[model samples]
Target: MRGRHCRSGRTGRKRRQKQQSHVDSVSLCHQPQYVRLMRFLHKQGFVSTLLQPALFSDTGRGLQTLKTIKPGQLLISLPESCLLTTATVLSSNLGHYIKSWRPRLSPLLALCVFLVCERHRGEASDWFPYISVLPTSYTCPAYFTDDVMAVLPASVRRRALDQREAVQEIHSSNLDFFRSLQLILSLPVEDVLTYEALRWAWCSVNTRSVFMSHPSNDFLSGQDVYALAPFLDLLNHRPDVQKSFCLQVKASFNNTTRCYDIRSVSGTPHFQQAFINYGSHDNQRLMLEYGFVAQGNPHSVVYVDTDLLCDALKRDRSLDQKIKFLRENDFLNNLTVSSEGPSWRLMTALRLLSLPQTLYHQWKAVLLGQAVSEEREEWSLQTARTLCQCLLQDTCKALDKIFFLLQHCDQLTREQLEVVQALRQEEKCILGSCLEALDGMWGQRDGLLSCQPDVGSVS
Candidate 1:
């Protein structure tokens, strides 16, 4: 009797779990825009019936397979007709005005204009299904408010500000061109193409567009290599998805079918979310560009700038010469600390800086990885320790400020707060790991130094 009761309890739990799963899948798939998108894709002959939109607890909205997918299977094959590219814009109703404009528009700006115009058109637009499903607003740094920006790391904050300025410049420079559209748009061109609207459109293109090579055209000013793949863009990035399943999904233009296709390199279990690699980007790049950060990202790094290095090592008369050498050799930039402690470029720069003015002739040898002396090596290690300790302190303070902001800053949305918090935590983790590695190295060196006799004192 006892055994039978336990069996029934287990069966009841399984049934409830299945019911919850069904609810999660149906919630987003049944949305009006998603329903319309599916219908439109089918009408255009998109034939990946195995994949369907499903919501996951961790990843939010992503595509999932209804059944187990086999290796080398075609996951998605979207017709060229369905893609939104600069070519699509050239052939659009606005194409006539675009072609006649005095200066040609870059492929990117052209896409931004098209997205904004079509979004204004509502259901009247031909690509309404695809446009309707795109995120109405993006969380990219360009959209961050001043208060939110204040919480970002110093390096990331600078880039974030630059991104915002670049978008603003694009809008300011093209205002007259946008005004010219009054001839075609029923609404006031300025009203529809406001800075906010243009920002939204820019973010959409920047974050969601896939790279699809197109032929050079006199009509476009810059690189013609972006395509907006609608349903396929729904796939999110997962860093370890490749390692776990060997799922090498490659997206390419299928010239034979005149469509864009994605195929899996290995089998994926049924009901699992399908992910695509967006290159091996660090959390900083991911957050700055895509408005999200990946936890446990193996590629995550903590950047160390020249100013910070100078501060840690104590500025000396030879600092300018050292800086010049680094710049000339292309080692001044990209100095960073990772899980393995300071990068080689960082250590090399430190070794050169640690040398006395008397031993300056050995600078080239240091760059060549030739060991100069134990004293110089010890100096470089000490300098590295100081820099990492400073970084750890700064990271802790940033985390504290973020926590305070999360509690007090009502101007930021819940999502914005979460992004800021996650970024700071990731930095802290990297710094902590780096400090641990540095400590181990420092301890080993201390023991070795104690065992060796001083060269100056030796008989």
Candidate 2:
């Protein structure tokens, strides 16, 4: 009788558990909050964002908590007091961010290796053991403020830093392990720039190789972090740059020796997009959020010394000292740019050159009967129009990039129909991308769409 009762109890418990499981499934299917949360994840990262609508809908708070749960997706809470915005970009590198970066069974080090392989198109015969170990590196800790430190675990304290360009390495035996692998990688660019060097360090320790963002020479002392001289496109480069020239890596290429061999991912042109120098300040903040951002307690900002380049241009008795300065100060050459421009000589020469991007040009236009000065009452509308014309005519990729520039300078207002309407008329068809531009006043202009529904609405 006792044995029979025990069996009956077991059967009853199993039946109840089955009923509970069925109820849980029904609740998950019907939940609205689950739907919204999944949508948010879908829009955020590379892999986590790729799961079909059904998979993540029931994940609930499982994905949102910040116990360092996700690899590529970082959780951050910034005070409303800060002047900065757009801090979401610092979480991962550009080479393999599939638009989603949630953590997985493997750490970030492992995922980066997987990406390097996935992005590679070369034959399997070309994959080498040494080259395969490039992604497991996590030496540099992502830096944050005091508030940021409190939320992380005790183990994480030794991992990140606060300085923008400072390469804050995590205290791990893996550091030495990474250095060993660097000696094996035959990176085309001999010296890895600061960020790239850390990436190389991580890649080496991963026991798997990954794609290098640029060739070894991409971070030349005098070039833009975005492009090399042979490289034409500057905008496709990631904006979160390590703004130091002090760090670099050493590599050797002996493919001929067949000592260790792998096929190369040749450089591709990325010039179709335009990048701006807004990177200078934001790069620091981005690293801060990413846990890889490094800094000191009492921070100091430093810039590249361009005094010699400016002086060289000024002393040259060539065509126009301004042109020489212009070439030297090209925005793409941040490693050689500075506040000093050989002082007055460079400025005066720049003024005389009639460069379109100059106070000289605005003045010249006024002299040539184009733009009117602030002194004249009639100059206001014409000045705005001229500025708008220049903005419209520039080699722009998307309205968002253009709008970003305009927002930096308050002179251009998105609501100004005179400028926007004129632009819409000339550009022919509206690009599909502009509809969602944050800086554009498209919703207000929906009235235009109502009257002409077929009209394309761009930012």
Candidate 3:
């Protein structure tokens, strides 16, 4: 879709063409840069058999199939030499000088440093062609102004703040190294290692880097480590798609090539575009790092602060110890609301924190998945119902506040409004699902209580 939609005004209409022109100028006008990048790829033996980069109206840029790719076709492949990874940076001519700073900098941050240094070099840098095509700006929430950020939900704001702090920390801690490299390379520090430059590089890596398990590299210790696959990154992300390629580092002409050996996971059909899974990331994460949000992310979740529950129970001073217990056990935060309802820890906390003193031990056993008597189960369910209803009420109030802001906040920008609306809608969907699950549980509870023997009819 176009980046912005007109809001039905003469001024808005005037702005639309200007904005579209700017987006196209960056996305479409960079054809020569992209073409040169592909040539660089071909020189390095990174070839695509079935797919090619094509611009679309809906999504700015993505891979379009050149031919009908079958179930087991190797659509694309890239040599290991093509990837701009940590190992690649370490092995570069500048690696010898930069290795001394490695003790303080992370592998990822080291790569960012390499990018900034190379960026300042212009055509002098070996990867200048690849660097030229990198995006000039990002749409991530971290780039949002304070006024725009204030309208976002608490969870998103918290995440954005945390990201800002991280970028600041990285910038501050590496300033000396950044300066040293500038002096060593005889370049201006302001133009090279500025926080803004590092941030752009960081986001570029965050959004596009792919995992590779290079057999030769042992410095990276994880299931798989990330590498910036240049041409591979041109393909836009589609979270739900039948992936038809597998990445492996194979021995190539002299150096190893990170080959995308394609074999369709499911039966392949006539699809216009191809995509690879970028991990099961939620919309919040995608927007924070990648500058985009999926319409209906299956991995989406809603977070209610633990403090909300504490506020709900403020009048009941007797639950203070239970709250303390919850904190000690590390169950007092990230109370997630999902399609399946409140997470297990959340439900357990709700039951335990609200249980009566007499039944506390029984409830604790039940929380631990032990058997409990029918009377205890009935009592627990009743307590759970009360707690769930309270949570539901709080969630609705939260939604109402979002609606109120959207209705009354006249100062929101078109971009800000879009972000707010998307986030609010996603949260509402999760909350609505949670409410449905609560109602179903309540119905089951009523049925259980009704089936119990009537003591009034008994002797």
TM-score for each model:
0.90, 0.18, 0.75
Arrange candidates by TM-score, highest first: which order? 1, 3, 2
Better of 2 and 3 by TM-score: 3
TM-score of 1: 0.90
Which model, 1 or 3, shows the larger TM-score? Answer: 1
Query: What tens digits encode model 1's per-residue C-alpha lDDT throughout 1-459?
Result: 999999999999888756633423434678888899988888988866778787777767788877788988998999998898999999998898789887999999999999999999999998899898887777788888887788787768889999999999999999989988987788998789999999998998898888888999878797888899888888888776666432346688999999999888778767767788888898889988888888678888888887786665444656777678778988878888887898888889877777677887887899888767877777677667777778878878877877777787564355776887888788888878888997788787643444322222211
Mark the 10 consecutive residues where model 3 has the least summed lDDT.
244-253
RMSD of 1: 5.6
- Give a tens-digit lDDT track for model 2, residues 1-459: 999999999999888755532311112222554444334333332122211112222111111111222223211211111100111111223223323333211233333332333224223412222223222332223323343333222222333333322334322322342333343234421332234444543333221221123222221212111101000101112232223111111112233441111111121121111111223332223233321222221121211223423432333344254445445645212321011211233222223332323244454444234423322212222222222333233313334344554455332233221232223222212112122221143333322222211101100
Candidate ordering by lDDT (highest first)? 1, 3, 2
Which candidate number has the best lDDT?
A: 1
Candidate achieving higher lDDT, 1 or 2: 1
| Cand. 2 Cα-lDDT | 0.27
What overall lDDT goes with each candidate model? Answer: 0.81, 0.27, 0.64
